[model samples]
Target: MSTGSFVSAASVENHGVVCDCGLPSPVRRSWTRRNPDRRFHTCKGRRVENGYIDCGFFRWYNQGDPSGWQFLALLEAREMMEEQRMQIAALTNEVTTLSMNAENDVKSKELGNRCEALKRDVQVLTERCIGLQNVLIASTVGFGAVFGVMMLMWTSNTA
Candidate 1:
């Protein structure tokens, strides 16, 4: 059986086996190409702050390799899991991009509305200024005419 890659077996009962360190070994499963689902015993060690330290004990739980059909099924299952993980990652990226685009679209629309409102305000202010200027010119012309009439009346009384 292959010994390159192994994973911890979940919910596996202990087999009353002890290593050189007098610790009970835990059952694990291999994931290598040669031994896809082979179970074995590995030293159960305490976890330190950095990592786990083991007694370097190892033993095979199963007698022989799995049949041809079983090996093929395990390989196929592993491939399917990898493909699903890749698909999930791609979908997550797509969702994030779409969310950002939606936010930018909303901000653009708000800015456009603000620009239009400012333009309307400027137009209203310009119209009011023009109206005030016309009123000032009319008042100035009326004052000039009143002054000319007063001067004519004064000259006639002096003569």
Candidate 2:
């Protein structure tokens, strides 16, 4: 990646550097491994969408590349950045997994509670059915005893 100020042709006219295509060159910084952060000027012309073409002008804006120690430091910084990015991705995945697990746990608890409530309802209904059956048995027995007594009294009167 390179960084630089976008100087228009008119703005850079005072610098007296112009490309073969009659356009003032723009100053840019290089971020490659060989020239990390070195500044340079290149042609302002760019290739059209139909074909590749440019003035191919190039010039160094800075005098020299960084020292050996400076280059090593840049490499270390790049590696550290990559490691940090990987760590961030791993943490993000863990958070998503934990969130899903928490949601499932809540749902499971709710289902368990609903099951208990249904079981209680069933128990109450069974008890009510047993009570109704007892009442029906008592009613039938009482009716039979009353009818036998009436029949016995009428037969004795007739005799």
Candidate No. with top lDDT: 1
- Kindly provide the TM-score of model 2 when superposed on the true structure, using C-alpha atoms: 0.60
| Model 1 whole-model lDDT (C-alpha atoms) | 0.83
lDDT of 1 by residue, 21-59 (tens): 887777788887677778888777779899988888888
Clashing pairs in 2: none
Pairs of residues clashing in candidate 1: none
lDDT of 2 by residue, 2-41 (tens): 3453232322432566777877777766666566656677
How much is 151 displaced in model 1, in angstroms? 4.4
CA shift of 13, model 2, Å = 13
Once superposed on the true structure, which residue ranges of model 1 sit more than 4 Å away at CA? 1-6, 9-12, 32-34, 47-52, 63-67, 148-159
Q: Model-by-model lDDT, in order? A: 0.83, 0.75
Per-residue lDDT of 35 in model 2: 69
Best by TM-score: 1
